[model samples]
Target chain A: MIRKALIPVFMLMVTFPIALLLLLSFGKSWVYPNIFPDQFTLQHWNDIYQINSELLMVTLKSIGISLGVSSVVTLLSFFSSKHISYSVYKSRWLFLAYIPYVFSPVILAATLQFYFTFVDVSGTFFGVILAQLFITYPFGVLIFSNFWNPRIKAIAELSNTLGGNSWITFYKVVLPLSKGVLLLCFFQVFLISWFEYGLTALIGVGKIKTLTLSVFQYIQEANIFLAALASCLLIIPPMILLYLNKRFIFTNQQTI
Target chain B: MTNQLLDIQNLSKAFEDEHILTQTSFFLQESKTLSILGKSGSGKTTLLKIIAGLEKQDNGTILLENNDITTLSAHKRNIVYLYQDALLFPHLNVFENIAFGLKLRKINAQEVKNRVTKMLYDLELQKHIHKMPTQLSGGQRQRVSFGRALIIQPKILLLDEPFGALDVDTRKQMQRLCKETLKQYKITTLFVTHDLKEALIMGDQIGKMQSGVLKTFKNKEEFLNDPSTGIKEEIEFWKNIHANEE
Candidate 1:
């Protein structure tokens, strides 16, 4: 019975904040002790794009950098896990999945800050993406470990027996078969980089500001309505994504 | 010797100190089926995998049509192993699964379509041309697997208990399909099974594996007459049980 109630509780936890944000975005100067706003207006929602044009640009940039990070990390971690899994010595190095994610992203960024400066990408978009990869890439690597199992290896060998070269088999069989996990990894990494604050601030030196930083900026300024709008913006994409593709993270059956 | 399609000499393999296959030698004639009977853990699957070049044997020479293919890679060996699991590529449609080998060989799309369509009709899976593996039944999955294996026209077909996981009716149906497919393709086949009935039903020549060693007989009579198989006693035991029940 309690378990049945938990979902309703969770739904309230999600919708109550969004409901308040919706009310705030439309409220005209809501203040404490005013159970309802003295006036209702679309002022904040209307001004969201017009007055806060920079928020729009920052959100776009956030998406761009997150996609870049997701793409590179997907490929990088794929090859990383593939190499470690397919090592000639047959020694499994699953530890690669742990190390990067184990470290705090801020500490990881600070540790690699000097190297980013030497590479002349610090305070740049590329540097910001690199900082986020420190967390996302390990997750991708761990997600792809399932693709390198003995059953899958046997499938690869079967491909070979059917006259496919390694490259051909990878393209036709391995990649197609792993499409589910790959999409999962890509979106998971995208969400991580999307909401990422610490690494972006540290490595980009606050120059490459994202929407997440803008929400923080509004909070610090005590602009509750704008902060609520920006927070909703940050939360909305992942919510829609999770709703549309729940199997991308949750399913256990190994079908494509 | 001229009739021989595959010949193995002094084959041996071990995992740690546990010997898996010991001096296993066999000869398969052109277009003949050789069935090996062994219990689980009797190294039946390992032996077939070694022959298909998926696994390396510690000592052996495999000659296919008088060519030494022992050092050849699995890709170059022209031998295909059908896993008992019927591992159809889950993402691919039935047509694509059947066309997988030809596509890998870089066959043209038109030819691939022609061949796959014909194979689909031949396997009586024309209605499921666009269906994924998950949508297929157990028997349909095996037919698709058989279609994939036979469409390639491989030099040797190694079947490792292809019917092991099916129910009684499905297993019988699969055996019929296997018999029809092999007869149509005329592929030299190495079929390993623990089922005595399946062994006799599938093989032109019969062999048995015991304690990592293999013995092959020239014909079914010879195999049935062999004392180690316990076929005589097995029949008598069933007969006596029936008598007692009566």
Candidate 2:
């Protein structure tokens, strides 16, 4: 019972820093000697808007890239999972498909950097999206495959007997049944894409900028206020998306 | 016969070195039901799977209305197999699960709605149409499974112990419901069960299988009364098992 009570306390502890960052973004700065800032102002927030449009463009670009990566990863995972689940070589190929995810991100990125340079697609959005998709695709496949394999053949048979062709069975019967898993996959890929830094920085070079990049830049410049403000801004959109996702998706269903 | 919906000839199947079925043959006229009875490893489920095209037979031919479907892929055979556990898609509600086949066929919204609504009413699942599979009672989920399979109007329905997961009373109720629904639809069915009583109640003809060969009889009376067969021993085995359980 005490353990249960401590959980909420722990959660509050974890969230305190984020809350403090939000507070700091509203023009409040806390010095080490004092318990609280002497004055609270919105100067940092205003400074962000006034100083540069790069942040705004970067935010929008991050959203687009994340969405693009999520969609592509979802599609690739969906088909590959379907194939793996139904194929005769499921056990063998499934193990092979997981190799990319099991490898360290830095190693994978370094390997891809060599490959991307060779292919002449280095430092492009496409290159970053592709790299990220590879990282996220296995997770998608693993999630969907866990649900699809044992159930797909049975459901497909049921659909076919009911006058449904293969495509119809997939779209109507299989897809609807897999809605929960797909939503989960989408969110997972989105999160991975949004906060991903190592692969993006390595592959995207200096041309592409994301919110994570902006946060890193401000922190490097020793502007703790700006960095905290940027981190707060970076965190808001994903939190809102996650909130909406939890509210609307799954709808009381426990996804496998 | 012209009306014989399914005919199996010298069907045999092996998994690795273990023989599941050997030289098994059967015939089912349209709208008739057959039950396969056996012990746990007696290959009753394997037989059903082979007929449903989910499992391959090593050396036999399966004819669906005189059309060879022995080599047909499961998706092309249109033989619906219900699992012991109702494998209703967890993400879809009862109505949507039942409507899955129609939607797959690209049936328009109105027709799909009309058919699914009637099926829900027919199965007495109207109130639970919006409920997820997990929220349903075992009997309710089996009924949804039944409706999901029936809505597709398959060439033949293969039941792999559909009510096996329910409690005894609920199992009895589901069995009765299944019998009534099959009669109403006049759909050909092959039900596999280890329960002799269930087979007697649901099967138009009962085929007792031992090892891999099937010994078929026309009805319950012959199945129980045939002196040359091992029906008595099978019944005694079940009786002792149940008695021990009690």
Candidate 3:
């Protein structure tokens, strides 16, 4: 009885904030000391596609950037982690992977901003993508390095002896075995690139307005309704990813 | 100029200051299994690795069926090295795991299906063909591993204490199965083990490894007579238990 009773309460606690965000996005006259909004409207939601609205473009750009960064980072780091894991100086190499995270992403981006500007990629979409890779790539390596243990190495060797060339071994054995970890790395790095503000701001130079930046823009202008809508939009992709992770990765992980 | 199917001449290896294998050489005729008996760190694994082309020898030539495979990459060597752990790919079901090598060779789909199905039946795993690696028991997994290796028709199969992780009964069963299967296939094998009984049971040609040197006995009787092989001590120890019980 207690367990059943606590379940709904827990779910409500989790969903309450989401509900409030949705309500606030639709709210027209919510003021201090008001238990409920005096009125509700769809005008704020309509602003998403209105003429001259940056919301739609910014949302699409954020999706594109996050998807690109996550895909590249996941692939590069998967291979990089395997090599580093098997290297004689494994710990030394892993320590280097951790170096980027030693400072905050913001500080790291600031330090790297000059290098980005020097390369003539500053204030560009590609620039923000490059800047996010600096952070997410190392994070990916850290996560995937743990995936390559002695057993995994032995399995790869086993594949080779079974007449599998390097490509065959990777495509047939390693990749299939690494599915769960690969999905997890992609999702985590996606989240990292999605919410990244500092590096995006520093490298983008305010010319690139991602959904995250738009949320901040609305908040700065004291437009709470629009800010709430942007926040709601920001929450959608990760929620879908979480659902995917739970549905596919974790389910497959039970067997792995 | 030699009848040996697999030949190693003056194989030597070192790791930094420590020499793992020193001037080791052996040869096995076709369809023969050479069981190498060695304790931990006896350089047995290093020897096997070099032959399988998984590791490079500091100085040696490995000839497989009269071809110098000394510089061949591991995948091209057709020498399968089986570790103690079954190490089945977790994502693949039993059939897929067994078919893995054939698939890599791009064997036709129908032929791949027939061979894997036949191999599964031979390993008595047809009923569990769809089961994932995680769903199988330890012994079942090892059988699958064996099937996976054997399906490729390897030039030589190297067993590095492949039954080390099983319980006594399973080990015996696997030993019997391995013996029967190898005989049926006439596959040359290099079986490495620390277990005395296992070494005697698994190998047609028995050798003992100590301090990076391999001493392949002329015959089983010679191996048993050698004190350094430890069979006498093992026998004496067992006889004492029987005497005490009497």
TM-score, candidate number 1: 0.82
The residue-level lDDT of candidate 3 at A27 comes to 84
Q: Tell me each candidate's RMSD, in Å, in order.
A: 4.3, 4.5, 2.0
Q: Which stretches of candidate 1 lie over 4 Å from their true place?
A: A1-16, A19-57, A82-92, A99-127, A202-208, A239-256, B16-18, B105-130
Between the candidate structures 1 and 2, which one is better when assessed by TM-score?
Answer: 1
Residue lDDT tens for model 2, B1-246: 438889999999898899889899889878878888888998888888888776778999999989998887777787888888787876678888888777766789999999899888888999998898888998999999899888878889998888888899999888888899899988899988888789889998888888998988976788889865566888789999999999
Highest-scoring model, TM-score: 3
Error of 2 at A177 (Å): 2.3
Residue-by-residue lDDT tens digits, candidate 3, A149-198: 99988999999999888888888888888999999999999999999988
Clashes of 1: 0
Q: What lDDT score goes with residue A152 in model 2?
A: 70
The ten-residue window of minimal lDDT in model 2 chain A covers: A247-256
Tens-digit lDDT string for candidate 2 (A1-256): 9999999999999899899887766656567797556678877676657647677778878998999988888878888788787778887878876898788776799989999999987888888888887788887887777876665777666655555677777786677766777777888889889999988998988788888988998889976777787898888878987886787574635442
Q: Ten residues in a row with the worst lDDT in model 3 chain B? A: B1-10
lDDT of 3: 0.91
TM-score of each: 0.82, 0.81, 0.95
Candidate 1 local Cα displacement, residue B223, angstroms? 2.6
- Order candidates by TM-score, high to low: 3, 1, 2
CAPRI grade of model 3: high
True contacts kept of each: 0.82, 0.56, 0.98
